[model samples]
Each structure stands twice: as structure tokens, then as C-alpha cells.
Target: MARMISYCMRIIEIPMLYLQKRLGISRLAWVFLLPNLLLFGLFAFLPVVLNFVYAMTGSDQILLQDRTFVGMGNYQTLTSCEDFLNPNSCKDDLFWRAVYNTFWFVLLQVGFMVGFALLTALMLNSKIRARGFFRSVFFFPVLLSPVVVALIWKWILQREGLANAALEGMGFDTINWLLDRHWAFFWSVFISVWAHMGFYTLILLAGLQAIPRDVYEAASMDAASPFRTFRRITLPLLMPTMIVVLVLSLIKSVQTFDEVYAFTGGGPGSATTLLIQYVYETGFAGTPRLFGLASAASILLAVVLVILTCLQLWASRRNVNG
Candidate 1:
């Protein structure tokens, strides 16, 4: 064991001597950086480049040699329609429908997520009874797997589940939650907000705690009402964290698939189908799996996310500078 340890030390020391004498770089820097850089290039950068290559091809074949180059044919087909506003007029109507559904999901989910998270954070941050217990209860859902959360809600929304049972006991009809178009969409948004609100609530709570207590004390001494104190001090101070929550919520809402898929399976006539689900079903799930079309859609989604991220950075910079 001592000889083995000495051998390993010699190997490392040789590299150190070579790097220090020949390259003028500390061997330690390469040790820290090379592995991560190689991993990022292989896993992250390579896939993105391959996805773009696939998007330009016009074949269902997974192999690069078998794929026929079609230039912008896949993209053109997606944008080809009598009217771009109406998805039904397009050849790939399901893709357009998924885009519309995703837009609606982001609209409602981000609002409800930020609003509910703010309320919960405020409540938990107060001197209420069992504050720690309540905080734990709220955050527990976040720690659960997304699939688990969706399945739990699916069971609750079933005909014989607790939700329907409560309705039946109240002399109200047991509505089919997952089978309805509007209700399925509503519950998708609701369940997503419920599952993720805890995370954003924790972020806002941290922001709230970072705020100096003296500011609130000053407001109280000035005879400021609770609303006035929040409006004049809390909201202004919390804007940065709120912006982060908003941007993250928008991006996540756009990429929503796993939980909603487990819950609804994009059923009731494509009511809850989002862009990611559309891409999955197109590329791998359905007959005549259109890999090219799916790749185009994936590229579009990536472009949208990139634009959102750029906007976020720009807004953050503007806020800081102003």
C-alpha cells in the first residue's frame, strides 16, 4: 500500500513538473477545469449541435448517413398554412395546437405561481403559530418527485377519489376532472402551481429575510398601515427576486410535460398537450414517427427559451443600472 501510494504521487508530481516547467500553467488548474469542460462539451454542446443537424434533415432514420438533407424543408412545412394564426389550417395542426396550449399554460401558471408563492411566503415569514411546521408542510410537496405529485393529484381527481367524494357528500355532482377539456387544463395549471409554488416561496422568503427589520420598524413608527408598508418597502425591495421567479416560472411553464403527461396524457382531444409532449409523440411515440418535424419543433422551443433568457438578462441589467 505504501509503494502504491508513492507510485501515485510520482505520477501526479511528474505532471506537475511538466506543466510548471513547460506550459507555465499550474497542474492544479488543469486538474480542476479539464474534466468539467470535457463533460460540458460532450453532453451539452455536442447534443445541441446534433439536434440542429437533425432539424435540417428530412428522414425518420436516426442515423446521420441514412438522413436526407432537406435544408429548411422541415421548418417551412411547420410554418406552411393558409393562416398562421389558426392552427387547424396548418398541415401539422397538432404542433400548432400544442404551441397555443403552451402559451395559455405559461400565461396562467406564471401568474398563479408568483401570486400564490408570494402569499405563502408572507404567511410563513410571519409570527404565526407553528410557522416552522407550516413551512415544512408547504415545502414537502417540492421534495416529492414530479411524477409522484401528478399521480397523487390524478388519484384525488378520479371519480371515486377524495375530491369527488367531498363533492358527492356536499350534494354536488362528481365532475370528470381529467376527461374534460377546460377542467383538465385548469387542473394542469393548478397542480403545477401547487407542486412548484413551494420552491419559489422559499426564494421569496429568503429575499424577505434579507430585508433589514429596521425598515419595517421605521414604517411602523411612521404609523404606516400593513398595505402601505408592503407597497412602500417590501415590494420595492423584493422586485429582483420576483423577477427571477417570474422568468423561471415562464420557462418551466413552457417546458411543462412530465407531470401533466402522467396526469392527463394529453387526452380529452389534445386539451393539455404542450410543445414538449408534441415533440415526444412526434419523434418517438406515434406511427410514421416524424423525427425531422420533431427536431424542428425542438429547435423552435430552444430558440424561444434562449430569447426568454436573453430578455431576462437584459431586464436584470436594466433594473440594476436604473
Candidate 2:
């Protein structure tokens, strides 16, 4: 009995020692994490907080100088101003048109981008010849700067450019790919999807590879069809990744500016104008900048993004649970 007690005491002491060691390791990990946490708070968290505070002010003038606290007045003005929020405003229908254009862009871009990315990822994951070469070719676009992508596409879509030249060669009429309002919007969506699909495909491919082969094998042995295996085994396992891709694509499409600016310059009657570009025009485009109105618009845009992000988080959680 004494030997048994001694053996039990030794086992308990071993775990206690291990616990102490783990605590020390955790402390070291946290110490290494502190600098990154501080940097994130300074850069990311501070900017968001400052933006919120600036949204309540009347001007972008230095906070210590010409700025005045406007409470919800900025938001109120935005809601009431027909020129800002209503669709009938003349000098420009920009405010509401930007909102409408952004919505359609997000919807179409997210749908096609995510769908095509999933298809590409699945194909790459299957037994294919030159899989590595195919992946690299598909992913090459992701390495290009947004400016470069926009410029290349812009040149290609011009009147005497590659696209029109090809069409002319095929005995088709040379269509104004970027000059016409409707066609400009169409090409913008197309280019944006093409530029972004590669990155999302790689992400989905990583997620696909992480799914255990045993799950598919089990489904196969059960005489399940390929469609059934994908429906029951693959999608559920890939839900988290799909949610991530959806939220990222949605946010990116909503905030898009560079490609639109480069390709259409928000022209041909402002058909491809986005919220961010509108904010830029309002704040800096004219001689007398409407800083107050621009700030108000930006606040509204931020609010929309926050709401969408919250909804996405809720949906993702529900998907995980289900």
C-alpha cells in the first residue's frame, strides 16, 4: 500500500510539473505576441476609432483647428439631402447611382468569382495532367498589381485595342467595350472577376486539400454518386472556407475603386461609379471640396460595411453549427 501511494504521488507530481512547464511556454508565447498586438491596435483599431469620431465632425480640417462636433447632424444631413441620397438629383445622380452600381457589382462579382473559383479548385484537386502548371497559370494574375491589371485590361478594351481588333478580325463589328455606359459596366465586372478569381481559387484549393481522403473513400464504398459525395461530404467540410471567401469577396467588391477608376473613370454617364470613387470625388475632385458631405457619405458607406460584416459573421456561425 505504501508503494502504491508513492507511485500515485509520482504520477501526480509529473503532471504538475508538466502544467508548470506549459504555463511558462504560454507566457513566452504571449510575450512574443505583444508587439504584434500593439501594432494592430495602433494601425487598425486606432484608424477605425478615429474614422468614427471624424464621421461626427463637420470638416476634415485638423481636429484641433476648424473641426466642430456635429453630433448626428452629419448623418441627418445625408438622409435629408435630395442631392446626396435621392435618385432624382441632377448636377449628378451620383450618390444613389453609386449605391445601385456598387450593389450590382457586388452581387454579380461575388457570385461568378466564388462559383468559378470553386470549379477551378475542384478540377485542380482531381487527377489532372500538369496540375502544377495549370495552378501556376491560373494564379499568375494574383501576383500582378491592381494598377497593372487595370491598365492592361484598359488598353485591351480600347477602340483600337486587342479586344476590338480580335472582334474586327472575326468579321464582327468593333463594339465600344469601355466607351458605352452599359458595356463599360459589363467589362468592369468581367475584368474584376478575372483579376480576383485566381486568389480565391487557390484559397478554395487549400481548403479542398485539407478535407480527409477517407471521407470521400467511405462515401465511394457506400456506392454514393459523385454528386452525392460532393453534396454530403465535400460541401459541409468546406463550409468554413466558403464563408471566408464569400465575406472577403463581398467586402472587396463593395470597396472597389482602382479598376473602376482606371477603366471607366466613373464616366460614360457614371455607370461604373462606386461608393469609394464617389467619396474621392466629393472630398478632393472639385476646387471647393465638400468635406462635410464627403465625410457623411463615407460614414454611411462604413455603416453599410459594418452591417454586412455582422450579417456574414452570424451566417457563418449558423453554418458551422448546422
Poorest 10 consecutive residues by lDDT, candidate 2: 84-93
Instruction: Give me the candidate number with maximum TM-score.
Output: 1
Clashes of each: 0, 0
For each candidate, the alpha-carbon lDDT, in order, equals: 0.91, 0.84
Worst 10 residues of 1 by lDDT: 23-32
| Reference-based lDDT, residue 292, model 2 | 61
Stretches of candidate 2 exceeding 4 Å from the true structure? 1-64, 67-73, 81-86, 89-92, 311-322
Candidate 2 local lDDT, residue 8 = 97
Clashes of 2: 0
What tens digits encode model 2's per-residue C-alpha lDDT throughout 214-236? 99989889999999999998999
What's each prediction's TM-score?
Answer: 0.92, 0.78
For every candidate, C-alpha RMSD to the true structure in Å: 2.4, 8.8
